[model samples]
Structures are given as C-alpha cells and as structure tokens.
Target: MNTSSDDASSTSESVSDNDSDNVPVIKKSKASTSAGLLSEHNKDNNEEESINSMHRNHPPSVTLEDMITDICFHPKLDTIGIASITGDVFMYKYNNEETNLVSTMELHLKACRDIEFSEDGQKLFSTGKDLCIAITDVETEKLVRLYEKVHEQPIYTMTIINEHVFVTGDDDGVVKLWDLRQKGSEPIFSIKEVEDYISAMITNTDAKYLACTSGDCLTTINIPERKLHLQSEDHGDELTCLGLFKMESKLLTASNKGKMYVYNWGEFGLHSDEFPNATKKAINCMIPVTENVVITGGEDGIIRAISLFPYRHLGIVGQHNFSVETLDINNDGTLIASSSHDNDINFWNVQYFESLNVTEPQKGGKRKWLEHNLPSSKIHNRSDFFAEL
Candidate 1:
C-alpha cells in the first residue's frame, strides 16, 4: 500500500550504487512522508492488523551482532559458517546444550560475500569482493585451491551442486560453472551477456536444474542439456534476491522496489503467461522452508513467512536493527538462520506454532512453549574476527 514513487526510485538508485564506490545520500522527500502515511493506513486496516498481531505475539528469537555478509549451514554437520565484511569466516558448532565458534578462517583479502559447503561436506568454498574464489579443506584448515580472476568484478554468490560441480555469480552479470574434476580447467558452462548482474544462484537437490536471479529477471538452466531452458522478465525493477521452492518447480523473486513475485517454473518458457502473485518490501534474502512456505528478510529489519499455495502471510520475525544480507534454512527445514548487516547471526526454531498445537483445536489444553536454548556468542570483537586459523 505504501507504493510511493519516490521511495521506489530511491531504492533502485541505492541498489545500483551498491556495485560502485559512490554511495547515494538518502534525503527525506515528500514521497517518503506519503509512503509513511500509506504504511500507517495499511497497518490500521483489519486484515493488515491481523497479520501484524501474529508477528508481534510470536516473534522469532533474534540475536543482533554487527556486519555479517554471508551465512551457510553444513549439509552433514551441526556447524554454521558465517563470513563477515572484515574478510573472516567463523565456523560455529551448535548442539543441544551449547553453541560456540570452534574455528575461524581468515583467508580473504576483502569482505567475503558468500560461503558454501560441498555435497560431501569435505570442502568449503568462498567468494568475496576481492574477485576470487577459494576452496579450503575443512578438516585440514588449509587452502586446497584458489581460482583467481574468476570474475572481472566482485563475486556475490556461489552454490555447489555436487562434490565436483559449483557455480558462481558475479557483478558483471555472468554465471560461470566450475568443475573440480579438471585441474585449471575453464568453466564448462557460462551464461554471460545477460542484461543485469546476477545476485544469486541455486540448484535443485537432483542437480538437474539451476536457477539464477538478477536485478531485472530470472533464468533457469537445464544442466543435462547445457542450455538455458527458461527466462522470465516480468519484474519491472531490479531483483535483489531469490529462492527455489521444493524441486525448483517454483520460485520467489524479490526486487529492490519492495515487490516479490511468485512464479511457476512451468510457465517460465512462456514468459508472458506468468505473473507475480505477491509483493512485499525490499527483500535482501530468501530461503524456502517447504514446497509452499518461504522465509524472506528485508531492509525494514523483518523476516516474513509466506505461504505460496493459498498465497497468505503466515507470520513475521522482527528483531534485527539493520538489513538482513543473507539467510539459509537447514536441510531438514526445522530451523532457519539469518545474518544481517547489523553484524550477527540469529537462529530461530521454525516450528514454533505447530509445537504449541496452534494448528489444532484445543479446549482446556495446556500450551507447549519452545525455548531458545542455544548458547549465546557474539562476534563483535575485531580480535576474534582476525584471529588466525
């Protein structure tokens, strides 16, 4: 409802400036005031009030820390890897009783933008503003290989489809596929010449399909065919982040203009037939919890749980003081962890409502409450960030 033209324009400008050294100074304008008024009016609406109440009553437990640029959870381990703007990677182990960082890897010369684990969890891959991708052996704590000049600009995201295959997206709007089987080999697949820069890349569990979302569009590639199978461009603005649902059959795309688009993969080839069903605030990151449920974080410092099946707002987690940059859901889909520019990683129990039996009718039934029992650790100190591995 707060669709002010000025606010949208400012958001678009900020996103463009992010890739360059020039920082846009945000000035208060009449459009901003109108946007605020529109937001207040929407908040007072009955339907909006109901949604707001759900968010307020069962708020997610969020721990704030300062600029966390990237976050990843191990596929087979209980450890979560967090990369910071200060060019550090901290591996934190979480268990039933305690959660503490067991290792820190300072291997980058610039802010690390993304970190990922291989399918077997034997190797860790990271990319940064330094325009290089480094592969490290998690157990030995040694750099196994480094791919320098992988991109002409900063690499923003990376995803490992299997032990031998990985993909990276960079600021130059190129998505390059790397094969670990060949030594010093070039990318087996590359999707350059795209109009906008790619912000994220994701692969399905079967590794059959790959999805890439950029500032203005979403593209899907079929790995076997080695060709782009679909490309959709309905989004009128720059897309900031994206997430794939269940089997890569669905997608959630968010733009800097504070609009979210839900699309069916089948309709992608027929781009004109597909239309965005839902819209939200400017989203920075998105992760799917189920085939129909998605959690998204925005610049407004809120994470929203949205259902795609019936297209409803399930709830919201509001606690961060700054924009959430990256987030990931566990493989089991039971927990969600988010990292913010505010410099902290917060993990939340996702089944909070179901655990309370809120889905079932209850008369004189006892309420079951879930607690955040994970040990608290902060990464606010620079010494902890720069410590040697």
Candidate 2:
C-alpha cells in the first residue's frame, strides 16, 4: 500500500448511479429558491406534483443559476448548505426522494468560496471573495453576525472546528481561528505558514490539530498550543483536499497529479503510503462514505469509489459533464451530492451501501476485507510526540 502501484482498485466496476433513474420528488421553493436550484414541484400549494415522465429521464438536482463553489451537509439534519460563486447561500432539505428549500440569503457581495454548518445545525457560516464572513441563523433565516475584512485576501476555504470554534483560510495563506463566544471579532490565533492559498483543511477528531493542504505540502497546526506542529515534505504537486478515515488513524490528501497520499495519524511530516488513482487524473474533491470507502471526484468528471488499507478501486459511483467542484455526504451517509463547474448539483443514491447483507461483508461487499473498525481511539501509536519539547 505504500507504493504508487494500482491494484484491485483499478477495476472498472460502477456502482449504481442516479443519472438515468426516475423517482418522484416534491419541491417547494419557500423564498428566493427559484434561481440556482430545481426539483419536481406542485403547481398548486400543498399539492404533490406528479410527473413520473420527466422524473424518469432526469436526475434529482438543485439547479443553480450561478456556478456553485462549495457545499456541505448539516451536522444533524437532512439539510445542506450550498455556496454560490455569486456569494449567495442556499439552504435546502433533501431526503430519499424529495427536496424542499429551507431558505436562501445573499450573504456576500462577491463569490462565496466555502460554507459550513455549525455543529448543532442552528447556524451557517459563509466566507467568500469579499473578504467577509457571514453567520446566519438557520431557523430564522436572518443574518446574525457579519465581519468585514476577515482576511487581507479573499477567504477561500473554511471548516468548523466545533460548536463554538471555526477556522477560515484566505487566498494569501492566512489561517485564522475564531471563537463565537468571544465578543470581539479578532481571531484567537492567526497563522500564515504557507506561501500560497489554502486549498483544503481537516482537523482531527478531537479538534486538537488541523492538517492543511496548500501549495505542494501538508501542514499541521496545534490548536491548543497555537503553534505550527510541522510541515510534511513537499509532494511535488498542488494538494487539493484532505480526509481522515480509519477512525481518524490515517489522513488522506488528494493531489493535482491524480494521487492519494496517505499519512500516519499525528505524523504529518511525510506520507506513509501512496495510491495512484485508477484514472490517474486530478482528484478535485472527495468524501469518506464509509470507514474504508471514499467517493472521489476526478478531473475527467467521474465519481469513483476507492478503498484503502489494502487499497482497491471499488468502482464509479456517478459522473458529471464538467469537473466536479465539490462532494458531500448527507448526515446519515444515505446520499452523496456532487457539484461540478456547472449550475447543477447531482445527488447519488449511496444509501444502498448502508444495508449491505453482511455475510462477512467487505466494503460494498465485492471482496474479502480486514477489520477496519480499529479499537484504539488514540490518534497514533506513538507515545513520545512531545518529549523533545
């Protein structure tokens, strides 16, 4: 698994796709949901619009008038927050077969680069090219707080660390940690360790440290100590996104060179393993749908399922006409929604994987597997991480 070799994971099997499936859905646009999103709806209020014909030929989607930049699911609900290039935030509720617009707000003047829901799902935080961060109440659909010039450069990515703490990264490599409990707008700690803009960031399960991908390297920042932990050796390509799986024991970083760099947990200075994607194309976005399986969006517009440990290429989960810009799984891991460079957000039925008949099942149940449900909760096996200090 440490080599750049392609193994069983390079297969061409494709999981089911919703591209040509027809399922009736109810769509109700509450307010300002008309643009940028579309679903089957009733012409009359309280009416369940029945259109079995068009639904058969079309995939369920949220048609955005403007290009979508980033997307995320509510921590505890069936809702999702979609960030548009126009800086608008749209909240929509989706289930197995229906979608309803919760609310929408024009939060920023420029493009909204990222959006994240609070841990409790009561608020949504959005940052964008306008250099501002907006906090909106999900229930009331009203703006709660707004900060101007949150960063010197346009904010590009964001991640909520916990219920009260959140982090934002800018185009100039600045990473700022903010606390909602504090009355002032100043960040708890502002670190600029990378030379280029940040592409993605993922904090460990405990929110103790954040592993960020920027330029060609991976960096770890100690949240409690408020210091730079260390930076991994440059991987020779632009790192795009980050994912933590194996119960947070392994960290996976996607690169522009169509590779998945795997690292030992808490050991971010170098990669322990490398798995070249089947397509050998740039992996722009990815999410772990299960413990060992991750759905990756490629440069060629195919969504592939990839398994790790003893790595294997599961198969294609879905596809897009353009490169996928973002990918996210719902709260229950039943559905995965993908957004490409276009205005459509395609939702794939991943719920089927949840109810697999486990006659000794191994991820998607096509091969024998190992016990990936690790027993240890420790981030790593090392016992002397801070002894030198």
Candidate 3:
C-alpha cells in the first residue's frame, strides 16, 4: 500500500477532477508474504487482464467532514450513516447516480461510535462515548428507546444480525449479546473479561456463527449454543477490525500493528491457510466486497483491496488526511463509504475481478512484541485531530 502522506485538501483536490479521463492508472502491487502460510497463485489471462483494467480505472472520491468514529450503509437504501467523535450521527443520501451525498442528518451528544440499521432499514441503533445505545425511528429522526448504562466503558462497535438479535463491544473487553424485545438495558448473553478490548464484531450471512476480534485473537461463537467454537491466534498485533464474507466459513481480520489474516472454516477446525501481509500502519476497519474481496482502512490513511481465497494484492486508494476509523460496504457491493480521524467521509466506486497473485515470505526476521493499548478519552477527543463536519 502507498505510505506517502498528503493533506485531505490535496486529496480532495485530486478527487475534484473526477470528470478528467487522463488520471494516471494504478497497478496491482506485487504482494509479499510474511509467514509460511501464504502461497502464490497464477493469474489466468482473462483474470489478469481484468485486474489490470481495474487498476487503471481509479474511482473518484467524495468528502464529508467530521471525525467519523463509525459508519454503516442501509441494507437496501442508497444511503450511508456515520457516527462522529463529537457525539453526533449523520445520514447521507447518495445522488441519483449513487455517487455523491444528496442530504444529511445529525443524530446524537458525545462522539457516536457505532450505528446499525434494522433489517428493514426503518429503525436505527447507535452507541457511543456517552455509554448509551439508542434506537431511533429513521424517518422521523426521533429517539424511540435508550439502553443506558449498557456498558461501563465507551461502546466501540455493534452488529445487528437480525431484527431481534444484536451484539455490542466496549473498551471494557466485554461483548454483550442483546435481544431487542427485552426493552431493558440487560443483555441476554455476555462474554466478560476478554483478553483485550473488543474492537470489531461480525456474524455470518446464515447467522450460525458470530465472531469477535480483540487484540490479536479471534473468537468464534456458535450462535445456537452460545458456545466458543474457535479462538485463533492469527494477527501479529491487536486485531482492530473484522469482516465476514458470504458466510461463517470465511473471514478476514486487520490488526493494529499493520497485519491482515484470512481464515477458512473446515470440518476438522478453523484453518489458517493464508495471511501475514502487512499494511503501512494500523488497520482499523475492514469491509468485505465479495466472498474473496475486501476493503481495508488504516491509520496511514490508505484504503486497500485484498483478495482472500487465492490471496493477492488488488490495489490501494489514499485520500484521507488522518487515520481511517471506520468503513462500510453497500449491500450491492457497488460502493464503499469510509471515515477518518481527520473528520472526513469518502465514497468510492467498486471493482470486481478474479485471480490475483503474491510472493511467499523471505526468511530472517526479528522477533517482535505484539500488544494494543486502547487510547484514552483525551486522545479520541482531541480537537486538533477531529475536524468539524
């Protein structure tokens, strides 16, 4: 991925030339393996040509201001919602062509850290620095109910698998599973005192398994039995983000120390067949575009496309001025919405392809320590870091 630093304004200026057909084309960089797990794959002629074509057609960027802590897209609507460090939430309606923001809504008090829409997209749920999770009517913009004191620390992430079931993670290293029907601030099932603060949570399309990533480990929980199925030590550092592709069998994780891991579920157990590719900086967010393709954002301000099944580098897009805090892919997988600590939301077009390639690991590396320390409230609340929306 590109590591050069540029101001958000400079990036935005490049984006403003969207209609120019002369923009330089990007190429898929050759991937380098870190551990012995990853293998090289040959790209077929048609597939290789498509991958090259995609790199040439760079997507235009759209910018919105605010230190976006979390972002999510409505399952069906051409709209994306964002939560900010200022304790506010906003929804942006995309243009008719679905490329730009047409409208917006400010929804919350302290920084809003997480946001999720109901299965039907009529209701919205948000949790944040204030330690409260609120359910709101999306159409009327009115708060329907508030789950107060649901977590001791600020809630960092949330996932709504279905109408009745949802999961939340906080800085306290707790993952709480809730039943919306309960109407109270109590969780039906809770996993207390995990190894590290839970930064990301996800459930498969079948809802058979739920996965939560904390630090460098990934815990997979069987939905029906609420039992821990697998705990994989895959990342080199704290696992800061996760994405489930197609189903429970395939998943991806991004870590604070710049590593990304891909795993597949097998009858025998969870197998770590591929991984150890490093990012330029701490990876804070991931969004799966297909069963094999995912988009990742990190502290270095670059977004990358990763191919899972065969394992390869697709391309990287850089525009954000600060660390990218969150990202969400539309249900159709045609657009991606991302936010950063510099307080900007950017939109990008999607690309699809087959086979891509990478290199195996080179020997002789130094031993390294891996740990993730949660930043204090002051770090997250710094005005210099969080630009106003």
Order the candidate numbers by TM-score, best to worst. Answer: 2, 3, 1
Worst 10 residues of 3 by lDDT: 369-378
Runs with alpha carbons beyond 4 Å of true place in candidate 1:
1-66, 270-280, 353-389
Q: Residue by residue across 133-197, what tens digits does model 2's lDDT show?
A: 99999888889998888799988888888878899888789999998898878999999999998
TM-score of candidate 1 on Cα atoms, chains taken together: 0.71
Q: Name the 10 consecutive residues with the lowest summed lDDT in model 1.
A: 1-10
lDDT of 3 by residue, 1-389 (tens): 11111112223322332322222223333556633223223333444456434433423344545445667888888777766556666666774233455445455566677788898999999886778888898888888888887888877778887889888888777888888788668988887647577777777667877777776677877777766777775445777777666466766777767767666643213446546646447877777777767777778766766566556555554446566766777767666767665545566656333233323332223121011101100011222223322
Q: TM-scores, in order shown?
A: 0.71, 0.77, 0.72
| lDDT leader | 2
Model 1, 281-348: lDDT tens digits are: 47777777766677777777666665655554554543355666677866565567875544455666
Candidate 3: clashing pairs of residues: 66-343, 67-343, 85-111, 87-110, 87-111, 215-238, 215-239
Which ranking of candidates, highest lDDT first?
Answer: 2, 1, 3
Q: Which residue runs does candidate 3 get wrong by more than 4 Å?
A: 1-65, 96-107, 227-230, 234-236, 266-271, 352-389
Q: After superposition, which runs of candidate 2 have C-alpha atoms over 4 Å from their true positions?
A: 1-19, 22-59, 355-389
lDDT of each: 0.63, 0.72, 0.62
Model 2: pairs clashing at backbone N, Cα or C within 3 Å: 9-312, 9-313, 36-63, 36-64, 36-65, 37-63, 38-63
